[model samples]
Target chain A: MKLHVHIKKKISEFSLAVDLEMTDGLLSLLGPSGCGKTMTLKCIAGIENPDEGFIKLGDRVLFDSRKKICLPPQKRRVGYMFQDYALFPHMTVRQNVLAGMGRRPDPASADPFLERFRIADLHDRLPEELSGGQKQRVAMARIAAQDPDVILMDEPFSAMDTMLKWELEQEMLETLSEAEKPVLFVSHDLDEVYRMGGNICCMKDGKTGNIISNEEFFEDLKNGNSELLPGWRILPPER
Target chain B: MNDMVNFLSGLDWSPLFISLKTGVVATVISFFLGIFAARKVVKASPGVRAVADGILTLPMVLPPTVAGFFLLLIFSARRPLGSALYTSFGIKVVQTWLGCIIAATVIAFPLMYRNARAAFEQVDVNLVYAARTLGMSETRIFWRVIMPCAAPGIVSGTILTFARALGEYGATAMLAGNIPGKTGTISQKIAMVIQNGDYRTAGFWVAVILIIAFLIILLMNVVTARHMKNIHRY
Candidate 1:
C-alpha cells in the first residue's frame, strides 16, 4: 500500500507544511515538540483539516482542497493510536474493542483481537482498572479490530517510564510486524526513532527536512552530520 | 416534645409530596436540557459561547423573584406563549403545578449547565479525537465516553439542582402561588405557617427540609468517593 500526503496548516506561532509518501512498512516522523509531527498525523487521520493540498491512500482520495473533497475521519478508515491510549473509561476491554467495529458491532467478533493482544482476561475490566501497558494493548487491540487501511500513532510511548517504554516498544514492534499495514509513528526521541527501525522523516520548525532509511540515519550520525538533528546538537551514540 | 410530635403528625403531608414531585420533575427537565445546552455552548465560538452562557446563567445570578417575574411575563395566560399553550393544548402555567416546575427548572438549570460545561471542558480532548478515529459517532462518544468521564461533576450538579428545586420559595410563591394542596411546597408551607404564627409547624418543616438536603448531599459525596476509588484503581 502507498500513502501520499501534502498539507499546510497555520497555527498562531508556526505554519505546518508537510509532504510525505510512504510504502508498506513502518515509518517514523522524528521531530522536536511543536515541529508539526503530530499535526501531520492528525491531518492524515482527518482529525485536523489542512489549509491546502491533498492526501491520498492507495486509490482513495481522503482529502483534496482543489476538489473540495475532505472525507471525515470515520470514512478514511485510518486507525489513530493516541499517546494517552484514550480508552473509554466506562467501557470494558471487550466493549472498547467492539466500539471500534463500526455500525453493527458484534461482541464475539472482537474476541480474536482481544486474545491476540493478550487482553482476553481483561475483557470485563474497565479502562480505569488496567495498567498503562494493558491500556496500550487494549488501544492497539481496538485499532486492530477496526482493520483500517493505515495506522497513525502520535507519541504512543511518551507517557511511560523507561522500563515500561522498552517493554511496550518490544510488544508494539511485534504487533506492527504482524499487522502488515502501512504505519506512521511520530516521536521526538531519537532513540525511539532508531529503535522503531524504519524510514525516518526528520522534521524541524514545522517543515519536513529529509526522508532517510534507518541505516542512513545511523550512518549520518556516525559521520558527524548535524543537519539531521533539529534543535539539539549532535552527540556521540551511547552504544 | 409532645407539642412537636402533635404538630408533625397533624401536618398536611401534601406539601412533602408536592415538593418532591416538583423537584423530581424540574430536575429531570433541567438535567437533559442543561447538559444539551452545555454541550452546544461549549462547541460554539468564544463570543457566542459567552453570550449564551450569560443568558443561561442570568436566572441563577438574579434574585428568584426576578426569574418569577420573567416567567409570569411569558406564561401569564394573557401572554402570547401562555395563550398559545392554553388555546392549543389546554396547558396553563399561571399559578399551577406546571408553573412551579417551570420556575424551579428555570432557577436550578444553571447549576447543571455550568457544572456539565466545566466537566466537559476538563475532559481530555485527545479522547474525543481518538474516539472519532475509532469510528465512533459523535453521539456515541458523548454518551459512552464523555458522560461517564464527567459523572462526578454532573452528579454534584444534579444534587444541587434537586436541592434548589425542592427548596424554591420566592419564584414558586410568585409564579405558582400557595394554593393549599395544588402548588404548595415545603418551603411555601413553612412560610404560610410562620405567617399565621404557627412556629411549631414551621419548625417541623424546616427540620424535614434540612434532613432532605443533608441526605442529597450525602448521596453526592458517596458517589464522588466511588468515582475517586475507580480513578485510583488504575
Candidate 2:
C-alpha cells in the first residue's frame, strides 16, 4: 500500500512542514526530539489535524483541509505505537489485544496474534505486572490485531535498557518486515535508525529533508556532505 | 449511655432513612451527570469551558439557601415547569421527597464534576490516541480506559457527594420543608429540635451526622490508598 502526505501546521516555536510518500516498505523518520516526528505520525493517524493540505492512504483520502474532509483516528485504519506503548493499564494483555480486534470484539481472534508475539502466557496479566519488553510485545500484538494499512511507531525502543533493546529490535524488525506494509518508525538515535536498515527521512526543526537509503545516510555523514544535525546522537554498541 | 439508647428507641427515625435515601439517589444521579458534564467541559473550547465550569460550580460556592431560592422559583407550582409537571405527572416537587433529591443533587453535583474533571485531565493523552488508532470507538474508549483509570477520584467524589447530599439542609428546608417522615432530613430534624430548645435530640442527630461524615472520609482514603499502593514508591 502507498501512503502520501503533504501537510503544514504551526506549532509553538516552529512551523512543521512535511511532504513524503512511501509504498510498501519501512521508512524511518530520524529527527531531533522536538522536530515534530511524532506530530507527523499523529497527523497521519488522524489523532491531530493539519492546518492545510491532504493525506492519502492508497485510494482513500484520509484528510484534506480544503475539502473539509477529516476522518477521525478510528476510521483511519492506521496503527500507532506510542513511545511508552500506552497499553490499557486496567486491562489484561488478552483484553487489550481483544480491544484492537474491532467494534464487535471477538475474543477468540486474539489467539494467533498473542501466539505470534509470545505473550499468550501473559494474557491474564495487567500491564503494570509486565516488564518494558513484554509491554512492547503486547503493543505489537495489539497493533497487528488491528490489521492496519500502515503502522507508525514513535520511539518504540526508547523505554528499554541497552540489553533489552538489542533483542527486541530483532523481534520488531522481523514482525514489521513480515507485515510488508508502509511502516514509519520515529527515533532520534542514529545507530538505531541505521540498524533498522530502511530509507531515512531526516527532520530538523520541524522540517523534513529528502528520503535517502540507510547506507547513503551514513556515507553522507562521513563525507561531511551535510552537517551533523543536533540531536541525532550515535551511541557505541554496548559490549 | 442507657439514656442515649432510651432516647434513640423513642425517636422518630424517619429523618435518618429519608436522608440516606436522598443521599443515595442524589449521588447516583450526580455520578453520571457530573461525569457527562465534566467530559463535555473538558472537550469544549476555552471560552465555553470557563463559562460552563463557572456555572456548574456556582451551586457549591453559593449559599445553599440561594440555590434553594432558584429551585423554589423554577419548581414553585406557579412557575411553568412546576405547573406543567404537576398537571401532567401529578408530581409535586414543593414540600415532597422529590424536592429533597433535587436540592441535594444541585448542591452536591459540583464535587463530583470537579473531581471527575481533574481525574480525566490527569489521564495520559496518549492512551486515548492509542485506543482511537486501534479502532475502538470513542464511547468504548471512555468506558473501558478512561473510567477505570479515573476510578479512585470518582469513588472519592461519590462519597463526598453522598455526604454533602445527606447533610443538605438550606435548600431542602426552603423547597421541601421540614415535613416529619417525608421531607425532614437529619439536618432539618436537628434544626427543628434545636429551635424547640431540645438540645439533647439535636446533639444525638449531630453525632449521627458526624459519624457518617467520618465514615465517608475513611472510605475515600481507603479506596484511594488501595489504588495507589501499586504505583506509590515513597
Winning model by DockQ: 2
What lDDT tens digits, residue by residue, belong to model 2 across residues A1-239?
99999999998768999999998888999887988999999999999899999999989999999999999899999999999999999899999998888777778789999999999999899999999999999999999999999999999999888899989999999999999999999999977887889998989888888999998888777555644363433343472
- DockQ, model 1, C-alpha based: 0.74
Please report, in order, the local distance difference test score of every candidate based on alpha carbons.
0.90, 0.92
Pairs of residues clashing in candidate 1: none
Per-residue lDDT, model 2, residue A129, is 97
lDDT (10s digit) by residue, model 1, range A98-168: 98897777789998998999999999999888999999999999999989999999899999999999989
lDDT of 2 by residue, B156-214 (tens): 88889999999999999999999999999999999899989999999989999999989
Give the Å shift of residue B217 in candidate 1. 0.7
Q: Give each model a TM-score.
A: 0.94, 0.93
Please give the lDDT score for candidate 1: 0.90
- Reference contacts recovered by each candidate, as fractions? 0.81, 0.96
RMSD of 2: 2.7
| Residue lDDT tens for model 1, B1-234 | 897688667868999999999999999999999999999999999999999999999999999999999899999999999999999999999889999999999999999899889889988888888888888888888888898889889989999999999999999999999998999999999989999998878898899999998999899989889878744564
lDDT of 2 at A1: 94
